[model samples]
Target: MNDKNSTEPTQPQPPKNNVKGAWNQVCGWMQENLFWTVAYVIALLTTVLVGRELFEGDHSATFREWVLFFLATILFFGAVRFVQIFTSCIREDTQKPGQEGESKEHEILKAKELQKIELQKRSWLIFSYSFMLFALFAALLPFVFDVEQRSAAELSKRPIAVFVGCVDYSTDDEAHSREELRCQLVDSAQSPAPGTQAPKPITSLTQQTSETTPKPGEAKTSDTTDTTKTEYAVITNTTKTMPTDTGIKTEVTREITFHRYSKNGMWIINIGGMVNRCNTDIYCVRGGLSVPLYFVILALFGGAISLTRRIPEYQKQAYPKYIQIDEKRPKLQPNQLREYLVFQIVQFISAPFIAVVAYYLVVPESTVVSVTLGFAAGFASETILLMIRAVMDKLNPSTTRSTQFGSISGYIEHNGQPVKDANIRVIGQQGLEAKSDDSGAFVINSVPPGEHVLEIKHTTGTQSKDVRVNSGQATSCHIKL
Candidate 1:
């Protein structure tokens, strides 16, 4: 009994012990690599301040100001690149397999290889993210620092004109040919009147109405020669001719007031369908530091990957005697291809949810119904695909029950926190499968039922576990990696 008890295996200790050490190492690396990050943040803030001054201040650009601007630009780029390189270095060092005591030449060679990989990763990240950041900055800066209004002279230069015509007046007894006139004026052109002074053009027209009648006590008389002369007031049009030779050209001047150095100066830009507005001063001060927030996210991802890499190491340590390797499966069949296609279709359908969220938060005044329609279309397509798959499975029970038909539903995590865009894979007797999305949760359906292996695969490391799935049921699994 004692021998049997001694031979029995004890449960492996949790890697919880390494957490503190790993955190400490990560913090140390961050502190060392973040020198440029700090500088960038400071320079960015300074730029914002200077930009505000430029917008609101009455002072003209001085030689010193130009020099400082040049320096700030340099510092911004420098700090950005430096932090990028430093993070890359740390990522590379963590990925290396050998210990510190390896032969110097071998270590150097490994370092070179690691450096090459880091360079590639950094290049890709910087190229993609920096372009996005710069584009956003370029867009918003103009709106913040510039304010424009139309001048009165410019308004006066707009087309305005007046027209004139004549009409006749009449009473019940006899009609009189009274010349009733109307006048119109236009202000856009030079005054047509015969004077140097320009007159304000009449903007609108009005008419007066009146009636005349004799008293009831007046004796009735016929042809007594009481010819009463009726008078009427009217406006007449006049034309003024210009001398052919005097051709004096008139020019209108418009005034524009621009801020020189105001801290409140703001600019807004909308790019890639994202609308953002910021104070010129604030953007200048913080733009450089903004790049590293993405880096921090990447590093956190890297750390999670690094810690998970130890899983394979620990597997080797714990299961040395039980090691077994399986042969890879053959090429997928038509049905298999369809299954994979359906899964991909579902993933594609879910992608627009992010876009919907982006639109709502970023562009509040946008048509909500249109966005909703797009989302409905995408989601409906996915739902239809799912129904098709379900119907197909129901029609062919054997096919659905086969070892090739399985589903993997799981959440992605980093540092024990859910992380979006983390990829997951499920390896089964039939073949390899994968799925991922922005929400950090994924489901790889149409996989073969029965005992199959699941794995988390990423740039940093891979982890695997065995799970069993019953036909028509999705297998639930949660992997920290």
Candidate 2:
């Protein structure tokens, strides 16, 4: 018997059949994965198209036009999916020979203007997406390069000063002053010494002298000679009081000489609240990129997270042909529309906005934790909304979602003994009744939150009690029989 069993187990089998079956299974799953792959590809293409609108320049949109084809495919997928979901939910959709409906007019009406308008709308519809994936990705690109490239590239690093100690200006600066430097982005040691102040203007005028001609005393002119003073320097010594450090006004007479200088050689810039300098524009670029990185980037990532979380759900609702669950062609469901599908699409589109709202609710004590929380919030957008409703209910106690139903739990007892098999009915509400067990205990749930009447009946007698039910809390009713 052992030799027979061994021979039976060793019987030759066709290896091709086994390989074929395994290949079939692989193909089935590959098709299913392929659907999602296409959806994600469309998502990528949609982002690219949207980016064209955002970052316009002198570049051919050839690659982007191909992306638009992906958009059309995704829309077709959506239309088909919507119809399938709607049709499956329908109970009865039958056609009778005598009950057929038909249009009265033989020819359908069409307008050229309406057709043109629809075409334009169809063209613009190619760019919208479920989330802002590429925008977030693009926004993060600069920080990797522009913000800290030099520091990151250096091999000898971690000297603390290398990261935080660099400033745009220093006293040793050869040319630029402290306030004048713009794009050095590193410390310098070429400036003038500290406290070497520039010369202050001599405000007090002590005396004025002419510069146009020689003075009368020097020229040996007549004793009564008169000199004409033009706006040009005149040869007159005018005495005036001068400001003194000793608090005494001193008067002095002296000759003043005027010198000519080129207009291009002089300049004065008054530093104000804004410093719009630098050819590289480092500060502005850093400021723009960093704000979004710190405060807004996580929200976008969270939106992406929300997209990831819904992949399975989207797959579930999809037509079998679209989801490709197996190798066999699925029986195509009839096209029908449903309200639930519309809401699901709405949730997908609004996820990014919801994530942005959630971003503000975080306290950024730790950046990693904050970013994680933001992504969590986006992934759990519906959960966050429910939490918000719960908080509102707790705070106000009157919101619609806060309206809670009370429950009832009790038992029947008589003279220190439990009553068995007692029936209980709620008067105010329907379809909610309970019966006591051998232990004389019973519980009623989902009783509308308000005042209610409970009627209890047993072999001995019937007892009725008026009870108060509070929203979201359970009530108790103990009966004596």
Candidate 3:
């Protein structure tokens, strides 16, 4: 019985997380992949050098910080993704068994290839872990790595605040271009008055209302008091009795509720959608401060792909037993997010050009059509990448991009509104006529750089306007008819 038990394989225990052991392993891995490690280091240094200008702009400090954050996130996660892909390929290739009837020389070459591939797998895992941390450090240095706004007071330190509510112009008959929205505030600290401090959160407020009347012709009743608390307004109840001239007594009850607010607690605040950083302000609790939370939400979807299962390998398979361990699958950590981001980047590159090409073929007026085209670019990112690669390969290495032709992009308005389907033509320039979309926007490319007269055609009639196109620059045209 003892011998039989000993011979039977014991189930392997799951590996426990060992930080120190993992650190040592990572050091060894980086040493093995020194060339790739150096390349990543160079990329990190370059990003910091380039990102310095983000701080100098007065355009919008909040917007600039968000840009820096985005760049940092992209670089870090991108490195992680690339490393995973490299490791996956190496692991897959090394696992593959060589042909059964191969020559001696082929076998020797295969052995060398397998050895190189094995080293790659180890090095890539290290690169991903290390670079991901480094990238996070670079991006989070501004905010000190704490993005969560735990309390209303912390909101003062955040960059952006998005105001969402109905416009409150307060007695204005006509709406204007800017926003004057009175949004509910989480903490008054965000938008502070010069001398006032944030009001303390109202923990509790209580009020009660009751009527005292002799039950249809019964006797009078005594006064009573009741107390309870909730988070809202505070109301005071008052009753007054006066002697009547007819020798009868009359009783009256009244209740008044007034608005309560604090600089420290939840209060009504005015925020403009596209308005002021302000002379003074009030900020409510919006998770993640002034940051565009929708963008953050959308970003989560990019890295949400699940990791795929490894292909099952049999014990008696042609591949060596050492490649896999104890019939256990060595799970690769990344879910191909890095490779996916590459696809996204390629699609981003192609989208504008794709839209331009499509516009030339058919000038679409519907925004849905444009959005669908963008979606198509993302969905078929691999195809777009392949096409871009093909174009890059075909282009002459010595050729430089010269502004041989200029473009024109602008809007045609009927009074203040966009004139849809209005045609704008470069007089005597064949195939250069472009029709405006719903927003009165139009783009015309490949127009020769020179002074030209544009003819705008609508239901009413044609109007001519003179414009000059600079080399490789878009000429802005806003026609008010």
lDDT by candidate, in order shown: 0.40, 0.44, 0.47
Tell me the RMSD of model 3 versus the true structure: 24.9
Which candidate should be chosen as best, given lDDT against the real structure?
3
Off by over 4 Å in 2: 1-60, 72-89, 92-347, 390-444, 447-481
Q: Name the best candidate (by TM-score).
A: 2
Instruction: Give the C-alpha miss distance for residue 204 in model 2, angstroms.
Output: 37
Give a tens-digit lDDT track for model 1, residues 1-481: 3775467677998667688889999788778868754766777887777766654677788655665575567546655663454344222222324555779998788778666654654353344344334333432432344234222223223332111111111244123221111012122234456856654432222222222233333333222111211121122222222222333222222211111111222221111221111111211110100111221222223223322333233323322133334324322222222233333323332333323333222322333533343343233334434544675677874643334465678776655666666546565434455555665688877876677756565544445556888877778777665
TM-score, candidate 3, is 0.26
Model 3 weakest 10-residue run by lDDT: 306-315
Count of backbone collisions in candidate 2: 9
**TM-score of every model?**
0.23, 0.29, 0.26
* Candidate numbers, best lDDT first, in rank order: 3, 2, 1
Task: Provide the global lDDT of candidate 1 against the true structure.
Answer: 0.40
Task: Give one digit per residue, the lDDT tens place, for model 3 in 383-450.
Answer: 54465567668785865876578998888876478889998888658789899998999999999999
The parts of candidate 3 lying over 4 Å away from their true place are: 1-103, 131-182, 185-272, 275-281, 284-481
